[model samples]
Target: MEGFLQLLLNGTALGSIYALIALGYTMVYGILRLINFAHGDIVMVGAYAGLFTALAVNGPAHPDLFHFFIVLLAAMAVSALLGLFIERFAYRPLRNFPRLNLLITAVGVSLLLENLGQVVFGATPRVFPDIMPSMNWFQFGQVAITNQQVTVFGTSLFLMVVLEWIVLKTKLGRAMRAVSYSHEIASLVGIPTDKIISFTFAVGSALAAAAGILVCISYPKVDPLMGVMIGLKAFVAAVLGGIGSIRGAVVGGFLMGIAESMVVGYGSSTYRDALAFAILILILLFKPAGLFGKYQPEKV
Candidate 1:
């Protein structure tokens, strides 16, 4: 029982990170119907941004709360700008073209970002500065909980709540939902569809940035390619929960994380990565629309 509880706690922390990243995927897809494959790379970019900011502010040592906030904000800001740039330059012109074109362009942009990351950040992995002070917060029998896990889970939940508020309560969120429902209708209704789309990308990218930092806090490693596997898994989580459903993304992410943790604890770590793809396949076969996704009939 203690062992089970331990795995559950660890899974929840990891899942929250995946949830953060998956939210970006779901939000963009909900609004634009574009996968924005480059979204994952934005995580890498954000990690690098946070790393540099941390170094600039406190060198290699752990950061105080204020400095940590600064580092987080810097990463979010940089990633948000990059998201805007991608939407403006890479996606805008091709918007009216076939979706296949946009898809291909997204892939191209993803590759470009990965290669550029390799070139800019170098292929070598860098140690992410410890921004949050580490200590055990609680322990029971054989189960233990650390400050890092609490921070990751707490921070992620807070951000998710904020995002929920923005989507459901804010004027910008209303406009976003309107645009997501129907771009042509939203534009006709005097909503700035373009601006809304750009904002969606920005917000999603910022969340991804937060996820990147949270991952670094726990794992303490940064690399240009680090986002690849994690990003794929998050994408699976989005799909599993229902690609366009916010609630679904969160549920799917936790499920994926928990599943991974259970497998690692009770089974072999060798199959950990394969678990995501397996879940994807099962979800696709049994419920293509996902646990929270509703199917919409195409108008002919």
Candidate 2:
């Protein structure tokens, strides 16, 4: 029972991170129907930003709440700008081009970011600074919960709720939904479709940045190439939960995290990734629209 509880706690924390990243994926897809492959690298940028913040502040020591929040906000702000830049410069000019062109551009941008990150940040992995103090808050039998875990879970949930509120209750959210449903109609109705799309990218990137920072807190490692695998997993989670569905992304992320954790607990760690892919395939075959996704038919 204790083992089960421990796994559950760990899985929830992992799921929270995945969900954060997946929200970015889903948000971008929802708005533009384009998969920004570079999205993950934006998270990488955020990790580095956080790393820089830590190094500049005190190096290696745990940060107090004020400094930690500053670092988190800095990462998010930088990442958001990066995202806006990608959308404005790379994607906006090619808005009328074929989607294949956009897809290729996304891949190219991803590669460019990776190389740039390597050049600027170095390829060697850096130790993520201890921002939050690691103090155990409580224990259930053999399962010990710490301050870091609470912080990760709490912050993730707060952001998710805020995102949900923005998407559901705000006027901007209505415009976003309108654009997602039909950009032409949305534009006709006076919605600034282009601006809305840019906002989507910025918001998504901020979420990814937040995820990167939180993951660093949990695992305490940062590298230029770190976002690749996790990004793929988050993409898979978005698909699994139903792409374009915010709620679905969150659910899928949690499910993916729990499944991965279970596989690691019971099976070989080497197969953990294989298991995730296998599950994706199975989900695709059985329900391509995902558990919560609805299939839409397009006019020829």
Q: lDDT of each prediction vs. the true structure?
A: 0.93, 0.90
Off by over 4 Å in 2: 59-62
Clashing pairs in 2: none
lDDT of 2: 0.90
Candidate 2 local lDDT, 93-146, one digit each (tens): 988899899999999999999999899988999999898878889976789998
Off by over 4 Å in 1: 59-62
Total clashing pairs in model 1: 0
Residue 217 displacement (Å), model 1: 0.6
Please give each candidate's TM-score. Answer: 0.98, 0.97
Which pairs of residues collide in candidate 1?
none
TM-score of 1: 0.98
Model 1 Cα lDDT, one tens digit per residue, 143-244: 999888998899899999999999999999999999999999999999999999999999999999999999999899999998888899999999999999
